[model samples]
Target: MFKHSKFAAVAILAISAYHGAAFAQDAADPVVAKVGGVEVHQSELTLAMTGLDPQLANLPEEQKRVAALSAIIDVKLLAADANKEGLQNDETFKQRVAYLTDRELHNAYFKKHVVDSVTPEEVKARYEKEIAAIEPQEEVHARHILVKTQQEAKDVIVALDGGKDFVELAKEKSTDPNKSEGGDLGYFTKGRMVPEFETAAFALEKGTYSKEPVQTQFGFHVIKVEDKRKQAPPTLEQVQDQVRQLVMRDKYVKLLEDAKAESTVEIEDPALKKAYEEVNKQQADQKPQQQ
Candidate 1:
């Protein structure tokens, strides 16, 4: 995840403004703080506080003010010393500052155009459209007695036919873990179970057990169909937040694509262009995986 380090820098800036002798000794609006004739103003402290750590925002008013002032003073002292050492004239320092400035501008643009512009109505409309396109699905409720061989399954059927309770027969003869629960498989939709088992389970009428044992990699099964019903779709309220995220992501993507299409974007380096395209493709592929 991306993180912003602006808060740390701003806090230090705020500390510098408050502790310099000019502000501490003077009693006036926009109090000027000076360190060897370099002046700092209280307004600089206010601007620095704008980027303070969000977690510190809820502190008591006095504590927040004190911390902000302390941060401004520290920033001023370090900055003054750095200027004295002539670091500001270094080419590397200038390049680093330029890079950070561009990055901040990019982030501000995304916040204004993508994050802030996403609306609740758009999210709800997307959810409704998705819900309307869903198809009703069928599910089966079933139970089975699992045994090691077809002969054992046939024998279990014989016992059931001879009036032995299926639950007791399962308890005495079945090897599956569900034998403890009378072999009840509860409810499941198609594609959830192995093909052989699912085919036989769904083929039977309600209350009927398979006369011929079904074979699967798990073993042989004498399955009983308990019930069948159409599976219910999830209600919008149950997935409202998920739908909102999906809609916002779609909007953000469309906005980016539109901007790119409308602009003259030239990649001067072949390697960089390839890397950028690869990253976009990777992100596109991962969106479905996230869903």
Candidate 2:
């Protein structure tokens, strides 16, 4: 499956915290501490909390900020020594800094162009379009009297034939944990049960009990079909978040395509180039081909 880079997820987390810091800066961004004459911004606390030790995330919020402050102070103390030693001038360190800066920029761009651009109306329209394409499925509401042996199952069918109340009979004779609820499985579509049980349940007419015992890995069942109807689609409220993710994914792909069109990418290694093309193909495939 195609997916955005893991770095993108980290970037999103970092950018989201920074986004909040914008409006909350005056109230929340004041200097909480100083290290070696350098001020520590409350905004830095967000990066420290997210980018530093993973353990800090488990700490209570106030304690987390205090730890992050201490950690950042320690980093500054060592970073000052590294700077004094001219480590920042080293070629490897410079390259690492450049790469990190580029990654952070990419993350911020992704957040601004892709994540923030998704709207509720677009998500709802996409959801409705997807839902409309699906075929409605038939589901059955069933109750089953399960027993250890075929004879027990057959006897339950005979009792049902004698017009015994299915619910009361299930409570009296079934060993299932749900026996208290009359062996009621409620409503389910096909493929939700063992093949034997699902087949028998769907085959029985509504309001009728299976004439014969149905055997499955669970033993024998005397299933009674209570009702059948078209399974209802999930409500928009139940799946809005997921549909929003789909909208974001499509937008990200479009953004990538636009950027790729404007840039020059030359790969000298043939094998690496082929592999890169394959990955891009997957990304391209994630969006439907332009009509």
Candidate 3:
């Protein structure tokens, strides 16, 4: 992952605290503090708080701003000393500063084109589209008596056929952990359980018990279907964050695709050149499936 020095980190943190409109930097940009005779603007303080330390983020808004201002002040003091010592003129320091500047620019561009550009309306539309694409699945509520031997399972089925209570028989004879609850498996869609158990359970009508034992790796099971229904789709409120991310991803991909088309990209290294072409070829091959 990428990380900034304490100096660059604090600077970005301070700048992030400022409001979007504060970028205008008119007469409204007030001096929040002075460090080593250099004024720190309100925009800088605001921007810093945007990426406050995790612990500071939970603090009240005013407290967070104060903390960010303190950090900026510390950075400014150290930066002044570094400048006095001519450290800023060092080749290594210059290179670090260049990298930090480009990373900040990249962050700003990503914020504008990817994060901030995703609107609530776009998110909602994506959520509806996702909901429309869902296929209905049948879920079953069931209970079972799992036994070590097929004879024991068959005996359980015979007991049910003899008008004995299924739950009572299950509680007495089942080896499964849910035996205490008469082996109640709750509700599950297909593919949730072992193949044999799932198949036999799903084949039975509601309120019907299996006439024969269903064998699986675990053991033999005599299952009864208590109820069945189509699984309900999740509400928008339950999936709003996921939908928003999907919308943002789609937008970012399109933005990158357009930029790639208008730009010249080359990899001079032979190994990397081959890798890059293969990567792009894979993406291009998936275009038809994605569409």
Would you estimate the TM-scores of all the predictions? Answer: 0.62, 0.87, 0.73
lDDT, candidate 3, residue 261? Answer: 94
What C-alpha lDDT does candidate 1 achieve relative to the native structure? 0.83
Q: Per-residue lDDT tens digits of candidate 3, residues 83-167?
A: 9999989999999999999999877888899999988888888888888788989999999999999999888888888899989
Instruction: Identify the superior model by TM-score, candidate 1 or candidate 3.
Output: 3
Q: What are the clashing pairs of model 2?
A: none
Models sorted by TM-score, best on top: 2, 3, 1
Question: What is the C-alpha lDDT profile of model 1 across 1-291, one tens digit per residue?
Answer: 123567777777888876765665654546546655666667766776777899999988777766777787788889889999999999999999999999998778878876787787877787778877788788889989999999999999998888888778877888999898889999999899999999998889988899998999999999988899988878878998898778767767877779888997789999999999899999888764323
Score candidate 2 by lDDT.
0.89
lDDT of 3 at 49: 92
Q: All models: lDDT?
A: 0.83, 0.89, 0.87
Candidate RMSDs in Å, in order, are: 12.8, 13.4, 12.1
Q: Which candidate leads in lDDT?
A: 2
Best by TM-score: 2
Could you tell me how far off, in angstroms, the CA of residue 121 lies in candidate 2 after the best superposition?
Answer: 1.0
Q: Candidate 2 — which residues are off by over 4 angstroms?
A: 1-28, 289-291
